[model samples]
Target: MTDTDNRRLLRQLFDAALAVAQPSQCLHHFLPPPVKGRTIVIGAGKASAAMAAALEAHWPDEDLSGLVVTRYGYAVPCKHIEIIEAAHPVPDEAGLVAAQRILSLVQGLTADDQVIMLISGGGSALLPLPADGVTLADKQAISHALLKSGATIKDINTVRRHLSAIKGGRLAAACYPAKVVNLLISDVPGDDPAAIASGPSLGDATTCKDALAIIDHFSIAVPPAAREGLASGRYESVKPDDKRLQNVTTHLVATPQRSLEAAANAARAHGVTPLILGDSIEGEAREVGKVMAGIARQVVTFQQPLPTPCVLLSGGETTVTVRGKGNGGRNVELLLAMAIDLAALPGVSALAADTDGVDGQSEIAGAIVTPDTLFRASRLGINALDYLSNNDGHGFFQALGDSVITGPTLTNVNDFRAILIR
Candidate 1:
């Protein structure tokens, strides 16, 4: 097949993967039956607004009412549930206000009242409510450090749960006797419910000591309030087996593995043999790219893994250490590293994109790279190695006109990567 055909196939596979995670498809299965009393909805994530819309469509006469927070530009109009747009991967005043409101909404509910909490990947940042002693600025500083520290989401959330009033099962505790059902879209690698959205509605197995250890491991600078909170034991979060969560139920509606399988099915439909590398792969983004490049090379040079006209598919979140101040996300960084490693290898092309559309802080979803990416960049006076070293994958790909832009997909299942060897 031509390079264009291969690229088209890759895009098709990506779309297939995204479709499997859409709110309309995944939310219905997790929805609970209508309750006798009022049903209060509360949630925070990039997908929360879409999830709210899905709930409204699924149960138009269920008498549902409440609020959900999502990233700016991800809000969908819902008649009953109020949708609030807030900053993602970082907390803003808007998010703080909305979180406070949500906390208040769930309070004072009786055992008859039911709370349906929609949680997903971006919820940790979207539902920012600092502990009593800590200020929002402190949370902001800690959040910035964690993002740049290259720490895994699990470690980052370990600290987050201790610092926030709403996370770590405090949200569920607020609804004391009320029954809480958490409908979650798993974006974390292990699909830990406690880690997804910091487990606001589930019991937190992590402790203050775990949070302190993570802070020490990353050498993250903590504000005086946060430091004291971690050391004083006064900020302990709700623990597992806590009776507060007895009435709470958690459900996993969508996940990365399912999305990857959808992509594999699409590849097979396109007459390309699809090999799934696993959906939960993790580690440094550039390193993972190099490893994937090696696999593609083996397929091309030896044809041992599979013959020509084959596509390798993988899904997972990869981290970047962020040494340089550049416009790029993990997917772009991975694609740049892969392009450099492949160099001039013939008949190999690849695409790496964040399934949510926004990759890091950039507007582009990710990028597409061919074996000639380096040669083409060189012709344009762009040095691929220099850009990669500077963490400027967005700049490099943008110059080559290979960046894929799909603004705010609203639903996320982490990263999607595909390599086509023909």
Candidate 2:
């Protein structure tokens, strides 16, 4: 097929996957039976606000009240539920205020009340209520360090849970005798309920020891308050089977695997063989890109896994080691590395994007790279290798006009990648 046709088909696959994970589409599946008690809604994430809007639409006449925090620009209009915009991947004053409000809202709940939490990716940072002795600045410092340190989402969240007052089941615990129902849109690699949104409404299987280990593993610099909090043991989060959590129920409404399957189905409809490489792939971004490049080469050169005209689709979160202070997201980094490695290989094209429509802190979702990506860069006096080495994939792709900017999808299922070999 022509390049235009291929691009259209690929976009269709992406849209189909995103459509399945839309808040309006997935919210109904996780809504519990009409509870006789008051419904207090609370949440944090890129999708939380949209989820709240969906809840408001579905339960128009229900006695619903609460708050949800989403990344700035991801907020949707809601009637009763308050939509608070906050910083993401790093906490800010807005997140602190919103988080405090959520904690206060659930403080006086009784057994007769029901709390609905809309948790999704990015919640860890959006619901930032640092534990006692740990200031918001302290959390922000650690969060910034963790983001730049190339820590896995699991590890980053492990530290975040231990550092926060509302995360790691603490939010649900605050609801005490109230029934807490957590509706989750998982973006973690393994789709572990506890890692999504820092498992604010679910049990935290990770410990302070794990948090400390991650800090040391990434060589992250911690503030005095963070160090004390991690050592104090007083900041420990709630665990599963804790008597206080018996009334809390967590549900995974959507996941990366489901989104990947939707994309695969779209590919098949376009007469392209879709080879799923699993949805939980992880590891360093550039390394993962190299490995995927090898797979694409095999598909094209020897047809080991599949023949020509096949698309390899995968979804999951990947880490990035920040070696340079350049504008880059994991998806863009992966695409850049893949482009350099492919080096103008014939008939190979790929797209890497965060399903949430924001890759890292950049405005662009991700990027699209053709086999000639490196060649085009070279022709424009742009050194692809240098860009990758500097962790400036956004700069490189922006120069090429290949960055995929979708504003805010307002849903998170982690990263989505497709490599098409023709």
Candidate 3:
């Protein structure tokens, strides 16, 4: 295929991956029956608003009233549910308020009521209600450290669950007497309910001790009060057997694997064989990219894994240990590192992006790499290694006009990476 053809196909694959994860596509089959008393919809994430709108469509005649917090640009208009715009990947005042408001709405609910929690990725930061003795600023510091420490989503969330009032099944506990139906969109590796938004509407299997271990392992500095809460178990999350959480039920409406399968099917339609490397791959960003590059190189040089005219697809969250002074969206960093390792190997082209259409704090989804990547950069006096060293993959890709932009996809399934070999 020509360069233009390769780029177009890669984008089509990416789009297909995103399309299947939209609430409109994956949420229909998981809707819960209306409660006898009332339907209270509460959520937090990049997809919360869209998921809310989806619920409204399915239950247009039902009396649905609640609140959802989402990334600022991700809000969609909902008839009964109030949508609140908030910051993500970092806690803000807006998120704190929304979290408190959500908690208040679920209180004093009767057994006849049901809480429909539309949870998705990014909810941890978007619903940052600090626990007693912990300030919002304290949680923000911990979040900042964990994000840059290259900690796994599980570890980061373990700490967040202990420090927050609304995470780690606490939200479900507060809704006692009222049954909880957790409609989740999985973004974490392995689709662990407790890791998806820290299982705000489900039981948490992790303990405060786990949170303490993560903090120490990551060398994350915590405020004294926050430290004491974890050390003393004063901020423990609701456990799986917590009596208050006995009535909670969960449904995983969408996930990374399903999205990857959708993209793979799209590749087949294009006459290209697709191999899914994994759906729960995890590690430091650049290292994982190098490993992926090695696999792609093997396909090109020895055709070991597969012959030409095939694509490799995978999905999961990759951590970026940001030690550089540039925008280091894990997706872009992976693409940049892969490009460097490939050394513009012939017959290889790839695309990497976050399905949510935002990487790190940048609006850019991710970027693309091709066989001529090195040559193109050299011609433009852009040193790929220099940019990678400074963790400026977003800058490098933007300068080459190769960064992918898809304003807000309104859904999140972590990172999507595809490599096409020809």
Candidate with top TM-score is 3
lDDT of 3 by residue, 178-229 (tens): 9999999999999998899888887788888999999999899998888899
TM-score of each: 0.98, 0.98, 0.98
- Runs with alpha carbons beyond 4 Å of true place in candidate 2: none
Question: Candidate 2: lDDT over CA atoms?
Answer: 0.88
Q: What is the lDDT of residue 194 in candidate 1?
A: 91
What residue pairs are clashing in model 1? none
Residue 346 shift from truth in candidate 3, angstroms: 0.4
TM-score-better candidate, 1 vs 3:
3
Query: What number of clashing residue pairs does each candidate have, in the order they appear?
Result: 0, 0, 0
TM-score of 3: 0.98
The candidate, 2 or 3, that scores higher on TM-score is: 3
